[model samples]
Target: MTFSADYLLDRIRLKRRLRIWQGIGILAICAALLALAARFDVFGHGDHIARLWVEGIIRDDVARDEMIAELKRDPKVKAVIVRINSPGGSVVGGEALYRNLRDLANEKPVVAVMGEVAASAGYMTALAADYIVAREGTITGSIGVLMQSANVKGLMEKIGVKPVIIKSAPLKAAPNPMEDLTPQSRKATEAVILDMFDMFQSMVMERRNLSKAEVSRLADGRIYTGRQAKNARLIDETGSEAAALAWLKREKKVPSTLEVIDAIYGEEDLWAGAQSAIAKSFFDKTLISKGLSLDGLISVWQPELK
Candidate 1:
């Protein structure tokens, strides 16, 4: 009886060792697969066209420039489709993205498809594309610049608080919230807005092939439906992603059989997820603070406060 018991105990120990080894082997295989996917972009692989999404507010660090850089490097990507759904944001951010997309267009065919609300700076970015497509109900075309300031003197007085600001010149901080805007300060601010507005006008006229008078008529800081914009010659066609893809194949000669890859940057694994979350949080905070203050110029459309 003792000998039989000893043999059974030894067998159980051997089985446990095999189970552990099997688990380790499985883990090793999974790690190897993930490594391979990263090296080759296997999970997000495509042969010809690269689809990039430009959603939310247009920001500097939303992986847009990085994605364009990647597309420039990859020779296999024959064309690009930029999908936009935004109300617009900072002027500089929009300008940077617009220029980058234009640079990419010089290399390969680039198409911009507007989603629900691509206005202001969002429309600016779309101008960089070789062809622009919009849905019939898509809201677009707020071709203007805006500068705003708040007078909080009453609120400060009510709260028993006084804040003082020192600047190099009266015009340096022309639109301060703590004081009433002087006529001189207001004029200075208006001049800055006019300069930016002229730039915006020029870009639209040059890109959309509209005359100065035509652009002047459209640059009233008013939003338009896609049908209205198409009639006004601001956008090329009214359609969805499928129509955009069809244009790629029919006009640009990109193969329909080629896989369409979403080439947005920072779409890796868990580490990428955490990084994107942190970056998004920072962007949100910055946008909110900027919205509350009037420190800079914006190419955004602010709807009426009800």
Candidate 2:
């Protein structure tokens, strides 16, 4: 009898589901203890709630956006510090995120607390903040536009493969991946990139108060160290999450007693947690592989090559 990986995964999933209720029971016990301790004033400090952490990739999705919107509207939150650690993604993705951050800043003092890497579209999303706080060695910048495609014409010729297409205009599929790019097609692609780059430059200029020439100097698709970014006026300060929070309290005059709570994905919501755990379990058992494509555009942060 042969036992395949899929069969093993199915068995594991069944066992995991059987054990889930036990895990939930343990969680309930822990929560009860915490609640009892809090009721008894375990730390002797009064309850405080004002600030929270907004984490993860900012995309066109409604979940993250809705959470951000709710936090901005909450009266208890005096200020917001965005914990940004993304390498950036799509153009529309960056633009939508920037708009939300800008809107949040309008109501409260919003600061970007950058992590290890916040480049390209990441920096684009950070432009709307009142201040940008970065660690000493954070990687930032890479202000430019990029679009990539692979040409498989040579491979098709070698293997005798071809793609047939029907379109109204010749230019519609002129830059087909299975063929060489024509001059006209290359020009068209360059035009699109140039327009996006121009928009990025304009945003930086308007937000950072830099002249067009100054923005052009830094927009050469080069990333900079946190220290270098501060010197170049790209970032406001070099600091960690704690330092950013302290600055918000001192400089921004957020209430001293206000609590700094982390706004996690679940945020003590049981339904959300259950759904996430279930999805995670399913992926881990059935979909995870050694050579999965964890690269490409959507990654919030990626390491630079040596």
| Highest-scoring model, lDDT | 1
Least accurate 10 contiguous residues by lDDT in model 1: 285-294
lDDT tens per residue, model 1, 1-306: 356878999999999999999997776566556554643587666477887878776767655687797898898899999988888877877888898998999999999999988999899999999889999999999988888778999999899998888889888767888988999999888998899889888889889999999999999989999999999999999999888889999998988887776563655664443334334335333534244222367777657779
Per-residue CA lDDT of model 2 for 1-306, tens digit only, reads 989999999999999997998898877666555544433336553333323333334456455566668768767667777777767776777787788879888888888888877888788877988888888798889898776678988888789877676879757865678767888888987887888889989999999999999999999988899999999999989988677777877888776667665443433454444433333335333544332132222323344449
| Residue 19 accuracy (lDDT) in model 2 | 97
How do the predictions measure up, each by TM-score? 0.79, 0.74
